[model samples]
Target: MTRPKSTSAHVQPTLAQLRALIAVVDAGGFGEAAAELNVSQSSLSEAVGKLEDLTGRPLLRRSARGTVPTPAGLRAVGHARSAVQAAGDVLLAAQDDSQLSGVLRVSSFRSGATYLLPPVLVAFRQQHPAVTVKLLDGDRAGAGEQLLRSGQADLALIEGVSAVDLSLTPLLMDDYLFIAPESRGTQPVTVQELAESPLLLSPRGDACFQRIETYLGRLGIDTSSATEFEQDSVTLGMVRHGLGITLMPRLALLPVPDGLVLLPLPEPLSRPLAVATLPWRARLPLIQAFTAALVASLGSASGQTTPLALPVWNQSPKLEPEARG
Candidate 1:
């Protein structure tokens, strides 16, 4: 009788080995891939060698120019990339199922973070107590730019301006309100009337100032004579003391001072507020959770009768006042 044919056991490649192969292929050299993987060149080479031995094929060819993947290596690297991404997904899912502990870095302008984020953050903390939310505040343009360029912040809340290569989700449209001393009466202020009033305006280079100028320019109103203040608080204080009338977004009027009167602009104009993130970063569960919390908080704050939809530009929802005794 003929003996049964002998067969060798199949060898499986470890995740580290697959990662080494992929890194080498992408980085185009052993040295760079080793540095990226935070492993010694010898260790990375050994891992790739083991993978090659298991598969019985040469994966990479070293040259004077750089490392190049063999035909088989190219195919293996493709599948290796998918495997590595799958492994990361598994880890992220495990973290989410657990306590979800980690810092969620957020970038936003001072007004957005201070006036808008507090209530949302309070609710977020209650849901994920183990997660810490860190805030980095700056100007709107700078904050959003830094978040994308540096990859330091997971999310950014900023004005709805078109940022190339970044994804923007409009959350709300805040109307510009005419704030005047209570003595001016509660009557709605017309844009034409604003042309004659002594306006306390933000500095010329400010985004708010630019928006206001653009809006007024469309209405044939000239505000070149308006006095410029560097700080919103200073401008608001001047309005409080009856210095001059000022225009501010409704969201910025949080904790509206006792004696100031807020009137809707005769021709209503609103600035869009949006949340931004890199396309890749948006897929993270932690980022998704924070964004969901923000959306829910906005819905609760608005008390709208209709269902809230994203990119809600036309709905001017009323913001509930902070509790006062």
Candidate 2:
């Protein structure tokens, strides 16, 4: 008589099989689950079939409404989700703790990407040669929102005044300066003094535009006649050509362009610059590593005397005047 074959060998389900069951249960259909997993429907079905065979029970009840997890499948799917997440954590731990070896997606505004992130990225890359940093540029608010809410970015560099719910760490302060033609007088420019020139301001709805308006409003300067330009390059170009003077952040004036002079605004208004990330995301080893590297880079660049502590949202430490510049 032939001996009964052993069934123990087939009991263990593969990670892919577990993932397929979870995706089908979560997504409610084979096609939707396949799309979400970036695999073909047939392949997804095959994976779930293998999982069912391993357990010797049908994991999903297919119907016109959608695929629903059976009783055993319901319990198994719950465990599978946790298992998949655990597997991911293990992989991330291996990459982050042992050797950095994955893509780190960073989002920032144009100026931050250009002037601020280069040194930080360079230093991080030197330390974690296997990790690749992908930078995505957008407006400050947009980038911060994407990074914090949408989970599209691993980290973000954004202006400090963000409305979203996120964990923000102050990196530095960027001083707002007066940009004028070289022909303008050398003395520090007052709001009233600059108001006398043809003022090239950012468009009304812009954050920078609103900031300048508030600053000038306090000085009783009428800016109704200011020419508004949408792009920074255009505003700076106009200033370069003697069309008007404009208020610009020092970060935007790195390697100040030819034919332009940067003078300190009276009383020197500055905006705080911060790194933003989700609170949960901050706990990840990769994000923590990147944040440390970034802080070190910024600290080195700014020449801070003491060790830096991460600041809470809207609460930034005062840096020395030279550091702000």
Candidate 3:
């Protein structure tokens, strides 16, 4: 028998090191990741440092803004995610099938979670009492897509179908409504009139803001002088005080605050909200169960007489999404 060539320089990384690197990248900083993972920041740093040493490459770009993964670090983190997911799958596979049980990590924007998820969650709990569902904040633009792609979340409820890479199941169509104080009357405002008015914009760097900006800009509206607010509540308060008029999706205006009136814009715009997941994960029993529950819950609420299609994981040509109610 021939002996294999002698080689000993390569050192495999421990699961802890892999997890630390992934957590830092996902959470955007060691401090944040440490807090989320309930570990000391120093220990998280140490694990990432050791991982870098073992891999023979710099894995993080640390600076004042925050820590971000280096190019090599990103590649390493991808493999790390696969390894971690595989380990999780092993545990799930070994569990008894008497009751489907596992963690389903979902990332969703605040509006969707607050207004659309409660009923769906209630149904899911009734069906799978043993499963645990964890919700992560995905309020910022692209947060949901990134979380799912990075393996941090199993499901992501995001606005719009921009994330074509994932399997998307449209849940609702939220129309953009012109919002102003009731004192402003219920008259429909045209784009030119809106531009002339003081427009209070939503928090910057979100899908809602981006869509509104693009739509208004195309219509020759100059938003340069528009004041931006960090919180939706603050924006609504300002609108109530007649500081400016604003645009908001229907869902975000749930339980419309007293003294505010919502009117349809002369030129309508709408958001197609959808639930997304990795194509393969859509077929998992836990995800499928959730999907069925979501369809049943939302479908019932919308008074849809037709049966909505439940999610089925496949890579065939995409079908036209069901008409948004």
Candidate 4:
């Protein structure tokens, strides 16, 4: 395993250098970062060179194949971004003694922004009136994970596993409902029936939708008969409008938009809504509080347990050093 940039050297990175490094990594090359940063490639290279000297390791590999982060480079970027963010938080902490005002950036997918954010943001604003919060809905595959990893977002309310290394807090248990017009009839629909029926559902790329697809796949039913739409709201509208029947999260029914009935799933099909961030960022008060609030909100929504059961531990054989030795 490659180690991240060392902080033991006590060589402080300036804000300018931190930004330059993040930009280079995000843009995938210094030349591109220079264009985005409005600086010459030579200037960007100089900054990276200085960063390499400071960190005592090369951060990027460049060639006609384009740029790739060296093992050290990936670690350096993660640490560099974390360090820069910590510095900003420190400054904010100091400022809070006089004025408790700052920007809180958050990112999430549509379902999160729609069903999850309204109450959380409302409550957070009520508590932190001085702090300004901005929420952006993102594409699950690319932009959502990018915002968190790039240090562009303070807290990210993502679904799951865009990448493997993310440490996540289980936020809510979503009950999947098969929705149809009350006029459509009351009988429960099976996976096979829905596969062939006219289905109004969000695009395949949506996280919860993908989970439903996996469930369908598990049942060995092809989703070729499904008709894709923009989002749950629109799809729900179509269902209400009598266009087709579809699956939607139970929580997504807030306000219980009329003209439709939510049918129960034939099997247990639960999806998790989660809060995610770097594991090392676990201790920050903002992160801690945000996580607590989400879990609490989920509990309140469920009306059963305040927190989920104590997290289960893995039951596996421990690796023995003697086996390797």
Model 4 C-alpha lDDT per residue in residues 41-145, reported as the tens digit of each score: 887888777777777777788867678778888888888887888778775645533244678777887667887777777776676678787886674655666
Clashing pairs in 2: none
Clashing residue pairs found in predicted model 4: none
After superposition, which runs of candidate 3 have C-alpha atoms over 4 Å from their true positions?
A: 1-17, 24-54, 58-71, 90-98, 306-325
Report the lDDT tens digits of candidate 2 across residue range 20-51.
88788879999999999899999999998878
Model 3 Cα lDDT, one tens digit per residue, 10-65 = 56788999999999998999999999999999999999887777766788997777
- C-alpha lDDT (0 to 100) for residue 80 of candidate 4: 85
Superposition-based RMSD of candidate 2 using all C-alpha atoms, in angstroms: 10.2
What's the candidate order when arranged by decreasing TM-score? Answer: 3, 4, 2, 1
RMSD of 1: 11.2
User: In every candidate, how many clashes are there?
Assistant: 0, 0, 0, 0
Model 4: residues with Cα > 4 Å off, grouped in runs = 1-13, 21-79, 89-101, 139-146, 160-164, 307-325
The better-scoring model by TM-score among 1 and 3 is 3
Task: Estimate every model's Cα lDDT from 0 to 1.
Answer: 0.75, 0.74, 0.80, 0.70
TM-score of each: 0.64, 0.66, 0.80, 0.69
Candidate 1 residue 315 C-alpha distance from true site, Å: 16
- Taking all chains together, the TM-score of candidate 3 against the true structure is 0.80
Q: What TM-score would candidate 4 get against the native?
A: 0.69
Residue 208 lDDT in candidate 2: 72
The numbered model that scores best in TM-score is: 3
